[model samples]
Each structure stands twice: as structure tokens, then as C-alpha cells.
Target chain A: MADASPIETHAHVLTLAEPLPLDSGRALAPVEIAYQTYGRLNAAKDNAIIVCHALTGDQHLASPHPKTGKPGWWSRVVGPNRPIDTNRFFVICSNVIGSCMGSSGPSSMADDGAPFAMRFPVITIRDMVRAQVALIDHLGIDRLHGIVGGSMGGMQALSWAANFPERCGAVLVLASAPRQSAQNIAFHEVGRQAIMADPEWKGGDYYTADLDDPRKVGPEAGLAVARMAAHITYLSEQGLTQKFGRRLQDRDAKTFGFDADFQVESYLRYQGLAFTDRFDANSYLYITRAMDYFDLAEEHGGRLANAFAGLKTRMCLVSFDTDWLYPTSESRAVAHAVNAAGAPVSFVELSAPFGHDSFLLDVPALDRVIEGFL
Target chain B: MADASPIETHAHVLTLAEPLPLDSGRALAPVEIAYQTYGRLNAAKDNAIIVCHALTGDQHLASPHPKTGKPGWWSRVVGPNRPIDTNRFFVICSNVIGSCMGSSGPSSMADDGAPFAMRFPVITIRDMVRAQVALIDHLGIDRLHGIVGGSMGGMQALSWAANFPERCGAVLVLASAPRQSAQNIAFHEVGRQAIMADPEWKGGDYYTADLDDPRKVGPEAGLAVARMAAHITYLSEQGLTQKFGRRLQDRDAKTFGFDADFQVESYLRYQGLAFTDRFDANSYLYITRAMDYFDLAEEHGGRLANAFAGLKTRMCLVSFDTDWLYPTSESRAVAHAVNAAGAPVSFVELSAPFGHDSFLLDVPALDRVIEGFL
Candidate 1:
């Protein structure tokens, strides 16, 4: 694998304390955002692309992570000669406001120098995008060439096109929908409950006593169960059967005991444990809440078409054949709304063995589509 | 729901103290099986149809559960006018050897008068079938007209045809596989680990503690998590989305905190909690072990075709389009093996939004297929 590009130091932090009134008659304030950018802006500043990250992803889109020895989540699609081609376009990725990675979240120090925990204002997808817009103004960007993202990132991309149509020239959404499905929310809630049910969770305030409370609150077992459940959703049954069909874990005969007797079991355990290392349990709570609160058309009255009223941005929507999480029907709904708004749009369902995670995996077709669009 | 049919008094028990030599050279014994029959067996015994239950299901397939207020699991399919019409078929549903519902399991008393707990020998799918075969002999039945089941029950149905082709005339396997997939074993292991990790489990010996040891050993929270995880696999994403599309749990707005805010969460919790009342944690361990050990093709020299060698039984296999647990490919594999054996067989992938549980759900197409075949 290629080494990640070095982190740029020119990024800035912005804080806002003014309460932003919401459609639900609620107000959120005291938001702090950290953002980073790469490449140079053209005279017209139209080459800017904002990359949104998924549930646990951060702003390190094209750089090596500060703690983990891994490259940025989107390095494959954003580097030189890559789909987004960072050498030719300015790329900006921000740590989402409700995330734990150097952004305002439950883990961040509060007004009294204590961790915020559950004290942070509840945020939505629009709220995260709203903060991104503020960051865009801080960076002096007027128009974006495109806003691109998958999963939660895709939620942000859709939010930008709907909430701030004039700021983006194009939109690309992958493996996401207008809102979290009931099943999706249900799985997330299970994970959250697992964390909270842990005795160490201490009502989400373990950061004060220097307690290993997050470990407990995060419900490692519950989270592991949750991750295992979610992981199944990310793969096609065909993929799973092909990859690990009746394959025993480190044994030729069944141990008939409660050991990890299958490769799939080992894989799921690794995923759950690895996830806990970088992700804040509280961030999971907040981000899933934001996704649950998302309903683009609902914000613009009940008419979905009205959400994209007069939008001019070209939109490329991609759905995977096996991605039951956000099935093809959802993409069709978005395409319908975009069409009603007379916006330039393209949609395709790509054949992939992987399910919802296909967008993040190596899919040459996805690369080709993105490259062609760019 | 209609009341469960009264269980007939032809209950029989089978015990094997010596370890029964398995095809793998491994031995499993001290197996005691409990089973009950309903309806009258014809003189020819051709009216007998064994009903296999899914994971956590018991011999009370068409009878009122003695402990819980719930009716038999297959009540809908085994009633007077149902597909496997009890009025015509002498139904036999056994509590598989590894289960705890009136069966000799970890909860059964040993000669020492203490709960066997973890002392129960590890059982396999074939072992369960063998025990059932013993029961069939005790009842003086030379052959069965058919074996019908869904999920793990379906596994037993397939096992009957593969292991005792001469003893069965037709096999109706639904929503089951020839062997448990690696993913299936992995999920089971997670559940097992959850139970074992509970401090109160006391190494599965909680039954004799004179306290609510079952509650702890049952790992209610962990089991709930496990059930929630497994429940996701039981339904198609389309079904879940249609049933509970990101709707809040009794509220119109997101709680923005870590709580069961979604209806899906509430539903999953109900599923998990209700499961504990009727199921044993140790039984969960044993049955999952049996499922993981089930690879008929592996037992017959790694050739699936060999497992069905010279099979004389006709087979009717039904798979749901959304049943990811045992996808259509699995059924195809079984059908292919049966065809290789030159046995009459038919396969159909039924259309249903419900996932693996479609076999149990009221799908008209499934009814038509069963009615036509029977």
C-alpha cells in the first residue's frame, strides 16, 4: 500500500456559541469544528471538493492517522491519479461536529474543562453539514466542485445538496439514504444500550474520574454483538458463503464447545475490538442519533421534491445490488426528487458481492464511475 | 392465536450411555431424548410426519408449552386446515437431545440428583436425528411419510433424508442449510461468549445454586444482544424497513441520547427478553454446537454428493428469496446432491420480504408449494 500523505498544518479551528434554531424548535450552540484541506485552490475556487466520512471516520481523508498506523479512510479515491485526484482539486474534510476525533463531541472538554459526555447538544445530519458550511466560509471557499461521501458521509453529501444548493457544483452519494431505516436505527440502539448497560459506563461521565468508563459504557460485548450484527449487513450472503462456508476456525473437527470455531467468528471479534480503539462510545450515540433524525424532505415540508427545489448541482448516485441497508428503492426515490427538481443526475446499481460496504472496498467500477464524473 | 393441540400420551425416551462413534471418529453419548406425538398413527405408519423445530424451539411443536403461555411454534403449519394438517398426519416433534424442554439436557438430573449443567456431552445434528430414530423405533414405526421443518428444524429434515433415506418418503426442508455457515457459527460463538463472560454464570452450574442462576447463566443482557443480532438475520432489510422505517419508539423526535428510541429497538428487546423465558442458555450452547458440526458432505469423504448416495426419498426444498441464512444456493447444492443420487427432487425459491423466517410466516406461496407437494 502507498504511504499516506503527510498531514498539512495550515488547517484551522473555529468555534461558535450562538444557538442555531432548528426545525424542531430546539437551539444548539457552543460548537467547535476542526477541519483540514489539501492542494491549492484555482482562481475561481470551483475545484474544491468536500469529502464526508462515515460513522467513525474523521477528517484525515488523505493523510496518515495520528494514532493508528493506517492511511486516511478515503486515500484510495482522493490521491494523485485517483478518482477525486487531490493533485488537481482542493479537498477538504472536517471532523464532524458530533464526532470524537478532534471535534466538538462528548469526549471534548466542556465549558468547565470537563468532558461533555451527554451534555453536548444533540446534532443531526443537517447540523453536521451546517457546521461544515461554516468551516467552508472560514476557508474562503465559495463553490465546491462536488461533495462526496458513503454511508454517514453520504448523508452529509445529500444534506449539502439539499440544505445549501448554491455551495456545491455536484454531489456523489454512496451506500446511504435520506434517513436511517427503522432496522438500522434498531441495530444502532442495541449497540448504544449495550454500552450504557455496562457498569463502567457511569452515565457517560467516566472521563471526569479518569475512569476506564468508556470501555464499560461502550459495552464491548454488546458492541461486539452489535458490530457482528452490523457486519452481516455489510456483506452479501453470497459473499459470506463463498468466503467462509462451513469453514471451521483453526480446527478440522468441531470442538463442540463455545470457542471461536469459525473464521467468521474470529473476523467479527476483530472488527468489534478494532472499532473500539479509535471510536468514542458516546460519538456512536450522537452520530446514530443524527442519522435517525435525518429526513431531508421532511425538513422542506412533506414533499421530497421540494427539498431539491431548483438545485443545479450534477448528482451521481450509486447503489450496490446487495446493499440491503440502503436498497435500490431509496436511490430511485432520490433520483426521482432530483429529476423533479430538474437537476442533472445519474444513478446506477453496481453488481458487488459485498453489501453496503462495497463503496469503501476496492470496486473498480466505482473507481471508474467516480473518475469519469470527476 | 388458536390453542395448541393437546399432546398425546405416546411420549417415549431414549438413552445411550456409551459414546456413539461418529463418522468423524469422535464419540458422543449419554444422550437422552424426549419426544411426544400427536394424532393417531395409521397401521401402515405412512401417516407419520416428524416436525422439527428451529433453534430454541421444542417438542411442543403443535402443543401448548407446559411452562410458557405460548402455543406450539408450528401451530400454524400443523393445524387441522394447515399445510401439514394434523387431522391427517400423525405429527411427532421431539425436543432434540441437546435441548432442555422436558428433554435430558444440562438441566436434567444425573444419577447424583444434581443438574447436569455443562456435563452434557456435545451433540451434533446427526446425533439428534439418531436419538429421534430411536424414538421412532420405540413407537414401532417402520417409516415416516415425511419430515418437515424450518431453520434448524429444516436441518433435521435434511439430515433424515441424508442419514436414513429408507426411513422417510419425502423431506420438506425450509429455510435451512446442509451445514451451518461460518457466519452462523460465529454468531453462535458470540452468544456463547456473552453467556460465559457473565460473572454470575458460575461455569454453567447455576441451576443448583437455589437462586436466579438461570437468569445470570442465561446472560439475559448478552443473550438479548445475541438475539437482537440473530433477529436481524431472520428478516430481510426490506421487511425491517417496511415494518419500522426509522420511526422513533413511541416518540416523533429523536431522544438524542443513548436509549431505545426507535421502534426496532423496542421490538428487538422484546424478542430477546421473551426468548429467555422459554429457552435455556446451555441449550443455546449445545444446539449451536450441533449446527456448527453439521456438514453432511464432509462426513461422506468431503463429497456432498456422497452424502445422498442411493437416497430413495423424494425431496421438496423451499427457500425464501430473502432468507440469507440459508440462501437459494444452499438449497440448490442439496438439490444437486439429491439429483446426483438419482432421487426425485424439486426446489423453489419463494418470494417473501421476510428473511429466513419466511418459512414460519404466513406466506401463501409456501402454502401452495406444500399443498401441491403433499
Candidate 2:
């Protein structure tokens, strides 16, 4: 999964001419947004569909990743004849600001020529959407046909609808929540604590000139641990049971030691280690913090419906039955809020064992729902 | 929770004359078992009831903690007139091997007078029960009363019932499984990685002469992170939502940096840090590994029912509805296995929002169930 070749695409980076204001009451100068575009914008520029990536996702929506060579996280959902069909609609996915991908993040060089690291201003879901809006404005597109996202990407779509309701006509939110729950925040905190606990983290400034040696390239161990913890939440318990179920890893019996005795442990270790190679630890902390701070209802007079008051955008929310991370109840709550707001909304809870990741996995029902919504 | 005076109890340590055999094919020499006994032993000693503690628990039982002044973890259900009724039964709670309490564990001294640490042999649930059995032998108790436990303690109880069915008449297991699930092992692996990642851990030899300064004591940061991760799994998502929700941690708004902005984060941070003061990192690793290696059915021909085949001990199992850790299904599965073995068994799924910790929490229904079962 980590050693895929990069597929070429029309990836571009747009530098903001002015400083970008932040929710933290700070402004970031020289903000840059990296994005990839699939298909062509119509003559009227109204067939554009903005696809937001989830946490750890990048701009390679329909192409292979530049580093891992693996297919884009949502490659199955957005392709030539797929649900978001590049043949009919223009698809645009941009790397969020607080990410390690080719965007303005902790790993990016600052005004002083050093990596921003912890110096980078903490960003929010709305800030990410704002950056995408800048990219849209630069493309000379006044309005988009739709905005689609899953997980953190879904958060961006919801933020866009709440903050810039007129910029897009429709939105499809998949396996996401309107706000982060207390348990979700606790999980994010564990990841952050894991990352920060590593001595190699060096207070989030582990990037060095001696990059030739991979061992010296940041807190890989801590980042891997964080990834392993987070990965468990992405997949359902039933899914793990079906996939690994105390099965011995390449052995007939238990090792009776600290080594990975179960197949699940071996798989988690691999996933954790592989993640550190393509992602930055600081970016993980910042992105998770942003996600944890997301509370649409709290930001809008303590009523979730108020966030969608007088909204006109068409909304389609989809959730998987097995996703404990952002369970179907979360999506149902958002749908009820949208319904209360008198918005044209559709909600469906699809049966899938993959949990929060079912939106990206081979769930045929999700494809039909996205295609119907788009 | 970390600062409380000790309420003295008759805590005793029994050193085994012979080496104790382990599941890992290694034998531990000079093994010492620390235990606390409550109530009086009748002349026949048939009223003796052994109570096993869970993963992070000690032998405090119905007494106040020595490290923290807080009441014993199960003080709510193990007092004089409480369920398990000390007035009627001689209750014994022993610190399990591989635990950091007064027992022989990673923190215990080796033959060379240094802390065992990583040099300590890996142990298992059955190994722990074997140690407890040694202590029971020293006390001259044979074929006496019953065994009761919750979580890891419950595993010990099951192990005792299986390995020495003739020694005990009954066993009460609460919120535990016949084996550690794949998801549970994955969680334990994350915690181990977090601990091993800390530079201060110094490969498990962090013990220094300067014990005066707690900062240089050990890998407190890493251990805390591990505790934080495990703490999240102890409670139900609904329990967390009800306890903390999206509430801010003594602040009106998020700091937008890496601080604990949410109440849950703050609570978890406190829990993680507080744990470091009372627990050993290496002990945590060993205990969790022991738990991950637990599979009752695998020990007996890959059939759960075979684990209890021809068992004569009366068994009662209790599970909490909201406990995703070891949910009601786990208890049901164990009960099924016991029933299939033609043993006397009873199972109940109690309604409790505290999750896996319902056994330890103030659940009135749980109290009634325990009282009736005993």
C-alpha cells in the first residue's frame, strides 16, 4: 500500500496574494494551496465539483499518490465513469492547509526559511474550506455545482455550506459528523500525546538537514504509534474480527512474548509504520486539533439547525451502519437539523462492515448514493 | 486522585520456595505474592472467597489505596455488609504477577538486586492464577469457597476454574471474555509502542539514583500517553458524552494550539499523568501482553466449550450493555461455552452506561446481581 508509483495529474499550487485570516485570531502570510483538477470545467463554469479530502488525504483524488504510488484515497468514488464521474463533472481536490501534502503546513518553509513546524498557526475546518474558496476564486469560478467529502472532507463540505452557502449548489457528506464528540476528542488527544511524548519529536521541529538518513527524519516511532491507535477507530470491531480474529501472524502458535503474536497487531504495526513515511507528526496534531475543535452547533447559538438556517443547498448525508467513529446517529442528527432548517436534504444509513472507511471502500451502495446526490 | 494517605491493612507477601512454571515455557524463581485479606477465616476455612483485581488494579480491594487516598476500586461492592459480604466471607485480594503493586513483577528486584524490567519473563493469565494459587497454598486453604473477578481479574477467575476445577466450588466472572479480541490486542500494541518510543524509557532501565526528582524517575510521559489511550476504552462513548460532552476545559474557547481545549482531553491528560505516579511502564507492557495472549478456547483444542468440558464449578457471568470493551456478547459466549460443557451457569446483561467499568462503578443493579450471585 505504501510503494505505489505516482500517476501524473494537473496538480497546481496557488499562492494567496494577501495574508489569510485564521480562527485563532492570527493571520498567515504567503499561504499556499496545492490542488489537482480532473476533467474540464464547462463553458459556463457551473459543472465544477469540489472534492475535499479527509484527514491524512491529499489532492490526488483520482490519481496515484506521489509518494506511495497508491491510488487516491477516494479513487473508487471519483473517476472517469465512477460516482463523481469525471466524464460529466469537473472534480477538484485540494490539500488542506494543516496537512503535510504539498500545502502550507508545519512541514512547509516559513518566512525565515525554516519549516513552520509548531510555529504554524492552528487551523480549523472552516480555514481549510476558505483556502479552497481562494483556489476557486483564482480559477475564475463564481459558483460550484457541488461539493463532496467524507470524514474530515465531509467536515469541510459542511463548513462550506454553513459559511459560504451560495458558493455551492449542493453537497454530499459521507461518514462524517457535524461536531466532534467527547470520545472523539479523547482519541485525538491520545494520538497527540503519543506524538508529543517522543523525544525525537523535539517539540515538533525534528526536520533536519541530514535527511539522507531516514532514521533521523522526525518522530517516526511516535507517529506510527499514533497512527496505530487512530487506525483502530477507522475500522469496526466486527471488521477486525472478520479480518484478523486472534489469528497467529505467520506462526502455528503464540510467540508468548511481546512480539506481534496476533495478525491484528502485525497489521496495525505495519499500518502505523507505513503512515510515518508519508505523513508529518506535527501535521497530524494540527489536523486532529482542528477536527476536535469542530462544533457547528456550538458556533451557531447552541442549536445545530441554526447552522443551516435559511440554507438553500441540496444536501445528501450518508453513514455506514458499522462506523463507530462517526456513527449513523451523528449523521441522523445532522439530517434532523437540516430538516428543521427546511433544507432539501436526503439521508441514508448504508450497511457496511468497514466502519468510517466504508465511504472509501468497495461499498456499491455508497457509489449509487453519491451518484444520485451529485 | 493521586494524593491520599494510606489506610493500613494486613497486606502480606508470600515467597514461593519452588519456581513457578509459566505458559511461555519459562519458570519464575523466588516469586513473591502480595495479598490483602478481609474478615475472619472460619475454623473449616470453607468460607474463603478469592477476589481477583483487573489490569491496573492492586490488592487494595475494600481498603483505601496506599498510593492514593481514594477508596478501594471495588469498595462499593466488597465492604462488610456489601455484596461478597466480608462479614460472611473471608475475602482475599492478591496483587497479580506482572503487576507493579507489592507483587513480583517487572518492578521487582532480580537475583542481581536490580529491577527485572524487560529482563522479566513474559507471563499470562494462567501464570498469574498459578502465583495466586501458591499464595492460597501458603495460607493452607484447599477446596474452599469461590473466586470472583472483573475484566483481567475475570480472566484469572476463569483460569482458576479451568486449571484447578477441584479446588474451587464456584466462579463469578464480570465484563470479561474467554479470550482477548483482535481489537483489544491492537489497543495494547499501541500502548506498548507509546511506552517504548520514549527516549527517557532508556530501553526500560530508566531507574536512576536520583529518585528524589520524579521527573527523572522513568518514562512518565510515555506511560501517561499509554494510560490515556487505554482510559478511553474503559468507558462507553455515551458515558463520555454524558460526563464530558463537548464541554471546554475551564475555558470559554479553544486555545487553538496543542493545549487541552476540551474537558475530555483535560480529564484524559490528568488520568494519564496520575497513572504514572502509581504504575510502572514495564509492568503495564507485561500485563497488557499477558492479556493479549489470553485465549481460553485455544488452550483446549480451539473450541470454547472444551475449555470448560466436564467442569463441575458453578459459574455466574455479568456483562454491561454499554461495554464495548467486553460487551454482553462476550459474556454470552462464555456462558454458552459453560452450558455446552453441561456445567451450572447463569448469565445476565445488566443495563449500565459506565461501559466495561460498570463492574467497578456505582451501578445499583450490578450490586444486586453480585449480592444475589454470591
Best by TM-score: 2
The interface root-mean-square deviations, each candidate in sequence, come to 2.6, 0.9
Query: Model 1: how far is A345 from its true place, Å?
Result: 0.9
Poorest 10 consecutive residues by lDDT, candidate 2 chain B:
B1-10
Model 2 agreement with the true structure over B159-233: per-residue lDDT tens digits: 988888878878999999999999999998899988888887888888765444556477888899899999999
TM-score of each: 0.91, 0.96
Task: For residue A356, give model 2's deviation from the true position in Å.
Answer: 0.9
lDDT string, candidate 2, A263-302, tens digits: 9989999999999889999999999999998999987899
Chain B TM-score of predicted candidate 2 relative to the true chain B: 0.96
In angstroms, how far off is B28's CA in candidate 1?
5.4
Model 1 Cα lDDT, one tens digit per residue, A1-374: 23355534246577865655544456656677887787777888778889899887888887778768798777777776678776678888899987987878888877787788888777889888888888778768888888999988998999999889999878999988877777677667666656655544667775645644544344455455555656766777667778877676788766656666677877777887787677777777788778877888878898788888868879989999988778877888898889988998899899998888899888989999888887
The DockQ-derived docking category for candidate 1 is medium
lDDT of 1 by residue, B1-374 (tens): 23445545356566755545554454555557777777788878789988888888888776677778677776676766577776678888889877887777777776676777887777778877877787788778898988888888888888888889889878898888888876677667666765664444668876755533444344566556667667877887779878886677778766665566778888888898888776777778788878888888887888888888858878988999988778898899999988988889999999999988898788888888886777
